[model samples]
Target: MSETTSFGDWLRPALPLLLLRLLIDEPGHGYGLVEKLRAAGISARGTTVYPHLSKLQDAGYITSHWQTPETGPA
Candidate 1:
């Protein structure tokens, strides 16, 4: 095991609530969510954020869908 605890561990308990707050006004993708958290002075990674997103989705707190860019190859 690593001796150092990641920033995620420290924030894990409150992460879901924080994430929900961020999404309340608008929908956002994973990377965007991480960026928003960082802008708010919280540091997190996909490993930290995505699992909570899954939990929220499982509990029906949020939903998601893939959006293809109009100009991108599909």
Candidate 2:
């Protein structure tokens, strides 16, 4: 992004909302979420995304469960 931080300055405030909207449209695990953000050119790194997701979950804005992939370790 234009900034030196993990995520862009423009997206800092709205990151949580964007993440919620993405989950609402299509639920995914952490890596997938990171991929989606990268696909959209949001410049979100795991270090940035995971903490937000955790906060969202902690605040009851979202929830998650473990799901093993067919070809990968859980």
Candidate 3:
């Protein structure tokens, strides 16, 4: 594969791990995860991050909810 494609190949697998690691710091909503990914230098878009979040929720690695009064970023 070309260099760019190879990089993307690696990134695809790493995204879930990235999301999990971010949540390890605390819990986050969809948008929060997107920002954390960006801030972590992961260049993730919502399209990618949200679906992963859903999968993570289904897999029991993470959870979610509406922004509550005491909810904070992860």
Candidate 4:
């Protein structure tokens, strides 16, 4: 495989570990987590991140709930 594909292969497995480390500090929403990962130099989109979130939830590594923002429509 090319270098880009090889890098992606490596990154895919690392995402879960990185996400768990982030969540250990505090809970966050999907978009927020994606941003945090991006800030940490991981290029992740919602499509990639959300499935891992769901897997973590399904495996009981994390939980989630909906909360309306103070200024947003509910």
lDDT of 2 at 23: 96
Candidate 3 lDDT, 1-74, residue by residue in tens: 65456656777789999888878878777788888778867777899888887898899977677654655652
- Candidate 1 deviant stretches above 4 angstroms: 1-10
Model 2 spans with C-alpha error above 4 angstroms? 1-7
1-74: candidate 4 lDDT, tens digit per residue: 65456657877898888889989999888889999988978888999989998999999999988898899674
lDDT of 1 by residue, 1-74 (tens): 76997775779899999999999999998889999999999988888899999999999999989898899663
* Predicted model with the maximum TM-score: 4
Between candidates 1 and 2, the TM-score winner: 1
Q: Give the TM-score of candidate 2.
A: 0.80
CA lDDT of 26 in candidate 1? 94
RMSD to the hidden true structure, all candidates: 4.4, 4.3, 4.1, 2.5
Decide which is better by lDDT, 2 or 3. Answer: 2
lDDT of each: 0.91, 0.85, 0.79, 0.87
Give lDDT: candidate 4, residue 56. Answer: 92
Ranking by TM-score: 4, 1, 2, 3
- Which model scores highest in lDDT? 1
For model 2, residues 1-74, the per-residue Cα lDDT tens digits are 47375446668788898799889987777778889988998878888889999999999999988887899688
Q: How many Å off is the CA of 6 in candidate 3?
A: 3.7
Each candidate structure's TM-score, on Cα atoms with residue i matched to residue i, is: 0.81, 0.80, 0.73, 0.84
What TM-score does candidate 3 get on C-alpha atoms? 0.73
